[model samples]
Target: MRWLMLLFCLGLAACQPRPVKELPAVSASQSVAELYRLEREHHALSALADVTVTRQGKRWSVTQGVVIERPLRLRVDAINFLGQTLFQMGIDGPLLQAYVPAEKKFYTGMATLDNVQRFTGLPLALPDLVACLLYSLPPGVVESAQIIETAQGVDLVLAPGVRYETVFSSGRLSGFRYRIDDLTLYEVAFGPVSAELDFPRRIELDVPQSDTRVVIALDDIELNPVLSRQQFQLSLPATAEEVPLNEMEPVDDQTVEH
Candidate 1:
């Protein structure tokens, strides 16, 4: 009888499930540079997007083409549904220029953050703009960082208020969220990875602060394509009046309500 009881206990133990091992916690000791390196890395890209801009309770929809080269070179063109060019803007490190055909005006100034904000209505510097568009972190000194591991993936809090959450699937970065002080600054969700480019075929950007959202349903996307310097150049008509970017009025409610 004792032997029978021992055999029954052994059979029960054999049928019991084994303990599941927990995944190792994500390391927080990664340096800022190392973390940035792990994020999206791209040299140059050209994309066409359907952009929707909302400001002061008004929304404007337009088709935009963007070409970007690393460090600080970008060109953007906005076109209306009528196939008319609304505006063309470019920045090459230091020089910034924009041509508004509707206003028949040309603007030029130093490619400073304030100037870029005045022209583009986006309060981001050249590098930040590029990073935002490319779904990556901007190149800057990170004051501090904290790593939070989640079932979805990991969230890296940088500096005082910026937090970047990277969603992982199959051990790959599938999406990202950029937040400032708990407010979502931007969110990007990528479509399937393209075999030719090894990047997402579609990318979406949502900016809540400015009430702006852009969906780049990439009909065609190229990575590191051969591009000429002239592609980043914009020429205005000789008769076009040049205006200073600083002199532009605020597009938000901060402007005087006359």
Candidate 2:
């Protein structure tokens, strides 16, 4: 009799309807161009991030400040916990310059994709880095984009083998995944929104290929601040040794070759 009762209860439970998950509505007519425009409008101009970088089992927690003048200009300064400037790097068009005050050495090289990756541990072009920092898509023409409804939110698959899966909550972008093929290039998550700019107060970038991760917490982040071209310049003393960026090794044993 107990077995018969259990069988009846199981049959009744199986007949009940399962709760359905409602996904966010995505427009079928949405184009990549529209999304790009939206992203550009929301991009920040200059930001000062308290960054923590972890790479290859080593960690460097520093305060980094970055200024971006779109179309191809960037400057970054990293200061250690004791408030000593560790390094300063600038990217002007195709030229890349970096100054290490500790070593009193200045390095210059072409800002190629590979070179930037070797130095920054980010496998992306300069423009791509700017976009990522601003929580926007890279500046380019997408051959096609497909919008699909996902359990998390909406996914936009761009042409040339790139995928962006976005998660939205409370009508704001919470995070996203940048993927190439089956490999995830970067995973970006946004923290609480700033009351002033409506932008995220914190952003996290995780790079799985090189085991690198960067967490940026913003303070006094200015959007579209007036910046002069001179701010991007890196000046070195006459006595400072000049070295080609490709030949400059972070350590004596590790050499990065072009």
Candidate 3:
């Protein structure tokens, strides 16, 4: 039921990520070395979060249980204010699956970036997906990173393939942009890192292309928690209507409340 509203709002607008810039030629200094250390800081994560999705000035949210591991394993369960399980979505390797309890429908598809964009309004591939959640860069990105030292802080830039700058103000981790070629895909702003857990307390994601935003406030985070195989597993139930992810077209907005 809650997800239904989110799906509707999604069709109204589009993924509205923040602005990203093209790559500039700058050399790395000791300042950029710090970025390398950020890579692979966490191999696994388990947490509970207040996940809010926004579109066209409309907001919807859910209490989400999140589990993620390296090499593309993920699980997310959305629970509403009434403690009802609204939906469940997960990824294992290249496989994607989701289930809606109210509709008794299950969705399945390949775990590609486009599918990710369609499902969560985030334009990220599996590896980069983990990077966004863990606040780390993809493997070897730092090796090819450039630097722009500002009076405020350092701006780390990447090469053509993925051209985005990671901003650090006053020697602290702030956030970054994500881009493909010349197009800015999205932007992320990070919250204060929890000294207790070494993990960020909140993450704000924007997809400017579609005007969509997502805010995740993480709580009770466990770094590298032991996750069971069953957590990433989902079976199509015989009673549920099996729907492929590609088939879930955006509903015509003429029928929705403007």
Candidate 4:
């Protein structure tokens, strides 16, 4: 299996955004507690959203009209640059399926309930994988975090390596900022945590190496809409070919989603 280190920002040191005014210093223990509460808050919500993924590359890059159903399914309706859905993935509990419409590719695999836990670093799963790309390690994400007043509302700045910073108001994750190495907010996911990630107003990815930037702006989103099993079922055309999991290229991102 040739697993491509899809986008691991491993070599870089700890990343930070331009810092704002400092708040009272929070003890590591308190930070951890706050982060845990936020995780619980995040997982409890369900939503449906339209997402766009942009990769700074020449051959293929931008993707739009991606859909995500909280705590499960993800559908890639279209991709730009490639100009088609290069891949689609869905998760129903532990069962995961990925489809490549362009290659007529289909795959089925087992995913543990704790897949996200074990895959805290650079592991991207269906549905939530997109979110992970924006911020790695959800449940145990915050080694330490502090609730501080930002220009907007309270923002949580997690300590340690990641350049992940989030803004929340009324317990909903309103905005987020993340970077890989020197990358400028390479990934961003936004929406009310009470609902699924359907309201991603903007998404951008800049790959300086490729000298390209991909941006996706979302205007409308639907949440928890009834969907048929067929929507998530990985049914391939009779002529569709099979792509083994071992054969499929791996997307490696040390920070989860680079």
TM-score, one value per model: 0.72, 0.79, 0.76, 0.49
Model 1 ranges off by over 4 Å: 1-41, 54-57, 110-124, 140-148, 252-258
Candidate 2 backbone collisions, by pair: none
Ranking by lDDT: 3, 2, 1, 4
Query: In model 4, which residue pairs have backbone atoms overlapping below 3 Å?
Result: 6-252, 46-196, 47-196, 49-198, 133-257
lDDT by residue for model 4 over 1-258, one digit each (tens)? 223342334323235355787543444334435445554433321222233222333222233344444455544443435455555555566676666565576766655333331222212344435444222234334544544555433344554344555544444444455544455433344433424552335444443443434444454444335666566556766877865454544443321121
Question: What is candidate 3's CA lDDT for residue 183?
Answer: 78
Give me the overall lDDT of model 1. 0.68
Q: List, in order, the clash count of every candidate structure.
A: 0, 0, 10, 5
lDDT for model 2: 0.71
TM-score of 3: 0.76
User: How would you encode candidate 2's per-residue C-alpha lDDT over 1-258 as one tens digit per residue?
Assistant: 999999999999999999997755443234333446547675446877777767777765667778877767878887777878877888888898888787788888988776565544445678877776776666652334677667666677776567887776555667778888899987888888775786788888888987878778888778878878778778876878988977854431122110
After superposing candidate 4 on the true structure, give the runs of residues whose Cα lies further than 4 Å from its correct spot: 1-65, 79-88, 93-95, 109-144, 150-163, 167-174, 179-200, 205-214, 228-230, 250-258
Clashes of 2: 0
**Selected candidate, larger lDDT, 2 vs 3:** 3
Error of 1 at 179 (Å): 3.1
Give each prediction's root-mean-square deviation over alpha carbons.
Answer: 5.6, 4.6, 17.4, 16.7
